[model samples]
Target: MPDRDVRPVRVRLLEAAARLLADEGPRALTTRRLASEVGASTMVVYHHFGGMPELVRAVIVEGFARLAEHMAAVPRTADPVADLGRLALAYRANARANPHLYAVMFGGVPLDGQAPPAEEPVAGRAASGAGTFGVETFAAETFGVLVEAAARAMDAGRLRRDDPEHVSAQLWSAVHGFVMLELAGQFTGGAETVLTSMLVNLGVGLGDAPDAAARSLRAALDTPAP
Candidate 1:
């Protein structure tokens, strides 16, 4: 397949770019440095991605793509609420697995020395107009997994009848904030405890019966994180 020729080099370049951004910040992301980091010629980056801006965009999108894979791997159970809880764990696991990519995927990776606007919209609300690099496609798709899971829970009466998208956004916000804090070392050894409680509280807030929600979340957490 044609992708066979493209995927390896592209992935290497993307990974190298993410590491450079993580280790040295945005200003350190030069073509020569990236090429040297991967022991490839600078032309490889340009050939694979065309230019720096495009490569950065690819890295962010790839981050989302990897996240989607992680969530998608979560096996669906009979209990939708439990599935949602497991998905939250999967989301955190992905972030912990690649903190560098998470930083680059979300905010915190300043773009070429440009400061983010004071009041940028959230990525879920307005990907392009959010005064940030646009990775709308993968971002939307990744968030869509949660939307579908939320809809399933709502349909099963595990949650109240509200907009699934809205509920998904709230859950995403909670997980995203927790992941960011954890990456920044804000959480102590109690990350697992805090996240479990937060998931249970989120479930209760969505109108689930407290006992059922806590039970489901605890059961889900007992399994290996997807």
Candidate 2:
């Protein structure tokens, strides 16, 4: 028998497919191509994810799962607004770390049946059923993490009294927009400073007093990302 490769086949194959899709479009996701990228056999791809369709679905789900894991890992601090800030930072970091997967998760490459319109969705990958702006936030599972964080802030009288889902959508839009810009190499300033400013502005917009919002976001910026 040929010497078996011992690397994590599923992860390697999935990541390779995402990169192919992101870099070269969907047509690049051939079985042979994926195998060559991972230095594995086509058999490994079929065995691990069944077929291309299955692999595509797995890619979308895995993207959201990885994002959820990142959000979930953020330790909830006493300051809910600060916690929201941390989650926002985590969202950006996850996107930066997994640009290809992030593209697949968002509207960049439509693995799902939904066609991308002229303007791409900033709040993609929302798993939960978004109440008002249902289209934004593609993965609700991951967005739910954001909602919970924002709700904590709202409950603590940090944000305005309103729907957490809606609040999360607004916040997600800002964070996602920044990530998209950053990934596109359009950003030229300090990341933390930019993010902190955006969050502080959003905080005030969401009903936090200007001073309090600035203070909370300052704490958020000072705290380390998870």
Candidate 3:
């Protein structure tokens, strides 16, 4: 007899759902379709996730978890600004690797003919509340990584003494905009050069000495991210 696949049902379901979404887009992810893909019954999804919305929520949460792992893997050096830039590159890499899922994760792609929740609740507030499943919690946690990095830079006197949250939000906006444009194929020339320039400029604006920060950013870009 053949050996059995012993993975948890929830894991199997999430994997199938991710593949379905990646291969065919969100519209292809239905309970029946996921069940068929995983060689299970629709009841399995219900048993694990309660319903399609919750399952979709799980998928988004899983994407953020992977993203956080990728960012966290960046080695922290004396330069916090450079560290933040490394995290931004990790963010872009994650999106590039998971283009289809990236859309669903941030572009507000619908699932099962229903749109995702409009508002993102604060992380760790309440999971039982509507739209408060792992979705908002994981998303917030992922963003928190950037915020905390900014705080560290501020404490080290490498960045401007502004609100860390605000600083992170600005950096995030710049990185996300560039990434979105890159993913859209708007970059006719060297996107990495542009990204590095923007990051260097951001570092200068923050508080770092312009010459040293730019040199560090250029050097950091030389080291390829995993």
Candidate 4:
């Protein structure tokens, strides 16, 4: 055969690298080793990814896409505050579901250092039939959601009339810090407990009365059995 193909080979190499990186740490990722692990020629990995740094970055991007898949799956509610809590819990669910990806994506990876290479969206988007959401872009979108929620609360005369940007930042920091720390194995309890605590803190800042947020939560919990 003149040549069966190399594109498939390159894709396999990337898949192998992703799996290994998920199972092993960054220290275990090497182009040569990855080639061996994938049963492909070293040239294939090098040709496909350019170099180790590029390959590592690709993995990081893929990991973020996976995280986005989990986040995107969180149900959007008519109640923005409830939507926020659901998103928070969904974040924890993603971490628990894919600890390996979570570890690499959030553990030691630096997303803000440099922009990721523009390439295919990755497995999650293709599988889910949805577009990829960059981490920063997603953060911005989530921030917008928080701002809308804050605005709603204020209009209802629940929350104080303050800067939505400031309140949004504060609330984002609270939820992100909690989830990030919990994923880093800093918390002792299960995700549900962590979620409860985070939602309570979020409510304090976003809801009129703590009870107002709590009632919404209680209703979610007692969603009609159908």
> In terms of lDDT, which candidate is strongest?
1
- Candidate 2, superposed: residue stretches over 4 Å from native: 1-7, 110-138
lDDT measured at residue 66 in model 3 versus the true structure, 0 to 100: 68
Q: Which stretches of candidate 4 lie over 4 Å from their true place?
A: 1-25, 107-159, 162-165, 219-226
Most TM-score-accurate candidate: 1
lDDT (tens digit, per residue) of candidate 4 on 102-134: 655554443333334554453443211124444
Error in Å for residue 29 of model 2: 1.0
Pick out the ten consecutive residues of candidate 3 with the lowest summed lDDT: 124-133
What is the C-alpha local distance difference test score of each model? 0.82, 0.77, 0.76, 0.59
Of 1 and 4, the candidate ahead on lDDT is 1
Better of 2 and 4 by TM-score: 2
Q: Evaluate residue 66 in candidate 2 and report its C-alpha lDDT on the 0 to 100 scale.
A: 73
RMSD of 2: 7.1
| Angstrom error at residue 189, model 1 | 1.9
C-alpha TM-score for every candidate: 0.85, 0.83, 0.78, 0.64
Predicted candidate 3 versus true structure: per-residue lDDT over 1-226, tens digit per residue? 9888798777667767776776687788888999998789888778877777767767676677667777878888887777887888888888887665576677535455645444444544432223334666667777898998899889988887999989999999998899889988899999978998899899998888899778778766765664
- The candidates, ranked best first by TM-score, are 1, 2, 3, 4
* Clash totals for all candidate models: 0, 11, 0, 0
lDDT of 1 by residue, 124-176 (tens): 43222223334666678789889998999999999999999999999999999
Over 4 Å off, model 3? 1-12, 15-26, 111-133
